[model samples]
Target: MRSIAKPATQHTITANAKVVDQLPFQDRQAYADARQGFIGTIDPLVITDDSGRVVWDLEQYAFLQDESPTTVNPSLWRISQLHMAHGLFKVTDRIHQIRGFDISNMTVIEGESGYIIVDPLTSVECARAAIELVYDHLGERPIRAIIYTHSHADHFGGVKALIDEDDIHPGGVRVVAPSGFMEHTVSENVYAGNAMYRRAQYMYGQNLSVDPTGMVSTGLGIALSQGQISLIEPTDLISDSGQELVLDGVRIEFQFTPDSEAPAEMHFYIPEMRALCMAENVSHHMHNLYTPRGAQIRDAAAWSRYIDEAMRRYGHKSDVMFICHQWPVWGTDSIRDFLTEQRDLYRYIHDETLRLAAHGHTMVEIAEMIEFPEGLATTWTARGYYGSLNHNAKAVYQRYLGFFDGNPANLHPHPPVESARRYVDFMGGAEVILAKARRSFDDGDYRWVAQVVNHVVFADPDNTSARELQADALEQLGYQAESAPWRNFYLTGAQDLREGVRTDEATLGTSDVLSAMTTDMLFDYLAIRLNGPKASGRNFTVLVHVTDTGETRLAELIHGVLICTPVDGHADADTSVRLDKPTLTGLALGAATLTDAVSAGAVDLSGDDELVYDLFTLFDTFSRSFDIVTP
Candidate 1:
């Protein structure tokens, strides 16, 4: 509900159609020919399940006007246009799709009993619309099974709309996903949920308005689902690289490929039909090197290995390979070509970055210098969508070598804001810096404008002129970015520079995430966020017992911090905190603090509150910006 405020600009958005200087026009004839090339280019409309209820309408998205026109990248703008153009398109016979649904395609697989859905968009509302679209044209079908190829929210958030509480049963439809899927899915977003989601706003341009100039695509596709998120526990977990399972009479062979996109992800082949479901493993666009949203760095080497394995295992045998989004590659040659290009794209980034790193290029230096070679670049599918070559190569280096480049000079350095002010002071005055930035801006070299303006904006967040110019520069960069995420990040940075930090209160915050966290994941996420410097030498221990679940654990606070220790269900300890999961969630959300919770009688503490406070002191808060991009 909160609109992050931006410095007043001459630009205005009216309720009626807007009037602004349009950029270079795209050739409609060319795009129409492209549409003709792709058999089902225009998505068919099929709204459903409102039972005459008007829940959502994608028709409005058919056209969009940019809000931060001057700040976004051009490449991202083009993709954004495509993203806006996305609608419901047919995938195959008996299968209908709401293409560009929730940044990815929602595939409706027809089954004898009902429909076997793969990756149900991002929320119940959107998934319902997509399902309705399928039923509107292809006849109504019940949902028998849901296959979650990975743990990402977009792929499985719509489970509730498809099947309700009565669905997860013996005779109820099966929910399939990767091993550790439920645990990882809940943990990934739960632990660092708030900050990550906030950063994701910038990363995916969530709040930035859609216009020719405001926000565009997320390199991967359109923007993320700002609506509610839901998760369906996978009834089937595929753990191995090669595994077979039949869901609702559909014979599916899954190939587990973890650590590429999400920590838990996979792809499966429908052998009898000679059709391969690539899942999100191989899409029409390039994947991200490192996501803008916070997460553990993905392994590029392992990613390449799994892609190759999928090709060797399923490429030749399949007639058509349909991905989770975009379109499908019909025929063995088409699928093989697509797989070969994608595989080499990762391989190229991995090997070349290692070679450059061996030659003593630092991560930033490597990212700047390394480019996707012809083998990878000539193929449009390898273009940065979800992942870009710049970040991915650096991720490869980070995976193999630690953040350090073996240089002692770079071992410890002052933070960027502090260092930027000093650098400007050394370079003379802010006037001189502004002059140089002006020249770069005039050259239409937005990247350089952003780089130089960084000194001023970071040095002084209150500098209105600096914020305005920097945002302006970023808008232009967003306009040019080929990747949706790159555009989103660029525009988001510009927005933040102009408007200030937009902490999404309407959305769930960090403490809220902490409260819902399970005992296991809470401890793990706490360990990561724990500030070691603050917890120097204090030590204490507390035993926790979930009254409702009867789960017990011994949490030790040593060296001024809390650590997870062996606490069996029967373990005896000094103090115990008795509360239900929701009660803990309330405490996590800051709705109730330690003292408040205890005073409210919601928390039953046996031993000293001082020790608990001491233990709480052991946990560290995480930093939103840890310098992933440029140091």
Candidate 2:
């Protein structure tokens, strides 16, 4: 499934309150020193069953088992401490939650008969740990229902770990979600699954060994649980504007927001508790207009409108308002104020940027021109930790219209590698650029050094000194960022430039998401990486025959454009490649070469052999660094 949210790997992370207090690194210090700065006040971390017997905890021998210690960067070490501080908190008289497990909190609602779960954490191991925590605190209770607040993975990815179908029994526990939740849930991650997963490694700091000065607060919170992922389809769906329902005796007032932060999302109000559950729609820091990992641009205007609507409808009444991330607010005034600032943050960025661009300014100029008024920026909640005003402003311009300013001269831009080389050639040469960059670096002007050295490296990628300096500049920037995501992006880039990005790791998605991917989305996903322009007006047509479905389709390349159409049940073409789904997946991942498949006869081809080369030609690649910031 497309993971709409970040990794949600909070299970293994720990955010240090004061990095200085942590001890010096020893062997296996990454996991050993996890409980460094701020951990829970309790004597021991343990969750027991009803009988007070031990159940789940910071796994039994976690420190001993974990060998890698990512302690060099203190910020990442600090963030990792947050996960180490996690525990199951009491929400109400009977309800409980395993907090700090993921960005999305898993609520355990106690029904008269059993338990009703809402939004299990991201991974199976973490969810299982959470369930044991609940049983230990509240006495054992059967699971009666599972409610997914939205389509995001953190909400549902751990279903299997929590409860199985056999546990639901004759009167199956109900599984509820917003309308089209299944479609949104599965499609979000898979279509562009490969590239998104790759970028997510940086966005989530997946491969980076955690430590202070490295990866910290994942823009959303601490890192997510690195446990098994699983999913289950919802049996009930909420589709209206205001829908009220009773599940397991608790009354839930759902504000159906189909296309807000997610394509399928909703928020709920608990009347008896006077609590408003604002899903990911409203968060601790300014939200993204566009996330670093790829996805359609979220509507800032629509997001603000929904928050305002939440304020008007439920604000004055909420005694304690809690969200998917961060700590909950208890006072009504405080709740209302937080909602207002978050809503206005999005609105301000949207309106002021368009206001400036109406006169004249390029995307970069608009980004530099617009800043949150001093009042908004000073407020802790509205700071550009996750979504900076600079980038979000540009996203707004990109959203409502195209990149061009109605000027023909600026419409087409040269490709990056080509332009970078020309730029270096015109500006003396790589050696000259490095010398000037070295001076800037020595002066502690990291931003300028990054700009100058990046040009040299992008122009001539082999220059080791340029790469080292740029990486050094990026590492310092990472240390200073208040936002966790920015820290991750900067540090990940630095780590890559220093040691180079690691081998592309494969992500095994949950079955629910994998099953929902449409055939069209599969091909379109591949097209994103197809090396286009290289094909350069080349013409090609080939037939792909499906083994499982007995379906036939023809792919046509005309004028460097690729098109797929379902032809005569079994389209006749120059090539009729034969392969099963597993082999096809292997082909996509490059586990086996085309020739290997051909030799093995796993793939049968006919007509012209050169057509395979033409088909592979249309792929376009993506870059980890494409100049998000200035030169």
Q: TM-score for every candidate vs. truth?
A: 0.85, 0.78
Across 1-631, the per-residue lDDT of candidate 1 in tens digits comes to 2334342222222201121232223333313311322223224432333354533344545444443343343334444555554555555555555665567778777777788888988767778766766676667877889899888878887778788757789978898898877777778886677578667877776667765555545656565554455665667789997688777787788898888777999888887778888787777668865786778888777787888888899889988777776667777887888888888877788899999998999998999998776566535577675678788877888888978888898899778888879877876757788888887776666677788778876776666667677777776655555567776777777666655665444423433223435766655655665677776775666787777867777877666455677466655556667877666655444444677777878888877767776655555444444332222
- Candidate 2's displacement at residue 33, Å, is 25
Q: How close is candidate 2 to the true structure, as a TM-score?
A: 0.78
Local distance difference test, each candidate: 0.68, 0.67
